[model samples]
Target: MAGPSRFVVHVPFTAPDRAEARQYARMLARVLGRLPEVDPAEATVSPEDDQSVHSRLFCDRLLSGGHRCALRAEHEAPCAVVESDR
Candidate 1:
């Protein structure tokens, strides 16, 4: 078995405000979350700083392992891995 699969995908970006950041994040998630590898319900977006927002997308290998790897390979920003439940 592949084991329990989960990842906290961090996508960084700058936005004018929380609303805009959320809009942009949602837009990005709309595309990324829609991918077979992503669980949209578990996806979340939050501001890391005044200039950047972080998008966390959880994934399961059974759903889209290939797609997730492809994204990780192509992503410009370094992704953050959630280490624990808390």
Candidate 2:
């Protein structure tokens, strides 16, 4: 038996700035997360010129029982799982 294989998909798009780009990435992640195979919490963004460097869009902190935080990165509030509108 083997575990599920994982991979990364790079989506290149132009944004007015880094902040806007991050916002777009987070939005895209949330929408895509509706699918069973998409893990939006693990989404990240990087500049087109320097793809090697990356910035996480979510806090994604490891919680008890193997769960992860669902808040934005560097959030001040306590770690929690945010419910999405279905």
Candidate 3:
């Protein structure tokens, strides 16, 4: 059997301090959880950074819709979609 399809969603934000970064990450996590195509329980949010954020989302099915939603949610985020080759 093959593994599930994977996606990397990059979320970028600029914050003046660590406190703001922490707060923003939590808020964004909620939004990502609410995405119709995402299974929040199966998603993994990586460490937050002062300049960017990223998450690894897994699904049994295709994820183009989910990718599009993430990009649309934050138009300024420098995000890209790449399908797993493995």
**Which numbered prediction scores highest in TM-score against the true structure?**
2
By lDDT, highest first, what's the ranking? 2, 1, 3
How much is the lDDT of residue 17 in candidate 1?
Answer: 81
Could you give the candidate ranking by TM-score, starting with the highest? 2, 1, 3
Which has the higher lDDT value, candidate number 1 or candidate number 2? 2
Model 2 RMSD vs true structure: 1.8
Residue pairs in candidate 1 whose N, alpha carbon or C atoms collide under 3 angstroms: none
Q: Model 3 Cα displacement at 1 (Å)?
A: 4.7
User: Which residue pairs clash in candidate 3?
Assistant: none
Q: On a 0 to 100 scale, what is the lDDT of residue 3 in model 1? A: 72
lDDT of each: 0.53, 0.91, 0.48
> What are the per-residue Cα lDDT tens digits for candidate 2 across 3-82?
89988999899999999999999989998988888889989999999999899999999998787898888889999987
- Once fitted onto the true fold, the runs of candidate 2 whose alpha carbons sit more than 4 angstroms away are 84-86
Q: What is the lDDT of residue 75 in candidate 1?
A: 43
Candidate 2 vs candidate 3, TM-score winner:
2
- For model 2, what is the alpha-carbon lDDT of residue 9? 92
